[model samples]
Target: MSRDRTRTRERSGDAGEEFDAEFELDSELDPDADEDRTRADPDDASGGFRSRAAERAGALFAPRIFIAALLVTVGALFATSTFIPLPGAGLAGVFAAAFLFGAVLKDRRYAETVLSGALAAGGSAVLDFAVVALFGGVGLPLVAVAGGLGAVVAAVGTYFGRDLRKGLTQDL
Candidate 1:
């Protein structure tokens, strides 16, 4: 079977005049058509590699997820420092924030979730370093260690959160 689709395009210029352009597209409805193609082959030369790379990058470090994780981690750390005032309060806050974020995350991909947690931890570590630097001189090594530890802690927390989410959603 064949179908005709009509599309209208409206154009306006600086002269304030408007015109409408109409076009008809003829398409054939074929049962054998490849309609289920989801991803482009990476080896293809016609921009497929770029698109595939972009898709992988987007999946790994989505901007929205990264920003949300960073904000949540920072907020939790600030709240913990202000209210708890414990020795390891920042780490505890990061873990809790990451756990809650992971549990609420809609994406079920493991790599993305873990990477988001790590990035968030690293960002919070930098922020903490900046704040501490204002008080007195601090060593870069300390920041590095804090970032590494935060990454590990956040990763563990996110893992447990994901497990909790899976357990809750699964059918008995």
Candidate 2:
């Protein structure tokens, strides 16, 4: 009304009930600008690397991180041992730690970090088994029994320590 410097009025049977229902535009706002800003999927987040990567990121990280940590711990302990001059023992321990960690942490991507390590450890343990067999020190059956015992220990640790068994049934 101030811009126009004029006004109009209407009366509804002298009750002053007439209301102005029309809206006048200021001419500065664009009418069709908003349509361009929206998209069907906006950045198309559901397709390509973003989608799979987002899904796998969490799955891959869990087992690998735990395995790495376990390897570090087992490796440190093996290195600090005074008697065994075999660096291969430390390497084998790292691998066994990886396998134990993988099996315990998550079912997904379990063997990638630990498989090679396990092979090396298996060879070393076999050699140890032969020596123990000849000398009646650490024989094959004894080592096998020890291995079974170690598995039980690891299973219990995974169960009570981090609840890794729960990860197996997690919705992928």
Candidate 3:
């Protein structure tokens, strides 16, 4: 049995030198032992089942920051609508809001900024629909378009904002 378990091979350059390697058959080891060791305790209070990505995402979308961003965006939109009587003013407000939000955050991750911007826009769209629904109905597809446009504007705004931050922090 030992001889069958052992493998022998000759070295290519060595003169009659042999190497032996031993391997264990599957039947010799208990597969359930590994499963038992790796399985997590169902009664454990610690969050051992959560993945790293989920943890990072949760950290990125902290409630305080997210709510602040949304409020800022909505306020900017309303202020722009009230003060500026021009086309695309709401979008400009969204861009500015996203830019400011990105600039204010200490963390360098842009995903949070972009997500906030998109959600803000989506929220605004819902509000718009709520108001318009009183008079007439609007299509739901428009809200999705607004969200996508918000994401793009947010990405651009975040890029410029981060660039400004970098420039300010750099040595002259």
Best by TM-score: 1
True-structure Cα RMSD, model 3:
14.3
Q: Which pairs, if any, clash in model 3?
A: none
Candidate 2 lDDT over 6-64, as tens digits, reads 34466778787875554434222544333332233466544544756877876665555
Ranking by lDDT: 3, 1, 2
Candidate 3 lDDT by residue in tens digits, 1-172: 2222545565757576766666545334665543343355565324445654577777766776767767877788778866897744676787888788767766764676577668767666677666663455554665677788777887788788777887888899
The digit string of per-residue lDDT tens for model 1 on 121-152 reads: 56555665676754666646656677677778
lDDT, residue 109, model 2:
40
- Each prediction's total of clashing residue pairs, residues at least 3 apart in sequence or on different chains, is 0, 0, 0
Model 3 clashes, total count:
0
Per-model TM values vs. the true structure:
0.65, 0.31, 0.60
The residue pairs found clashing in candidate 2 are none
In model 2, what lDDT does residue 84 have?
Answer: 59
Cα displacement (Å) at residue 51, model 1: 1.3
lDDT of 3 at 144: 74
Could you tell me the lDDT of residue 141 within candidate 1? 60
Q: Which of candidates 1 and 2 is the stronger one according to lDDT?
A: 1
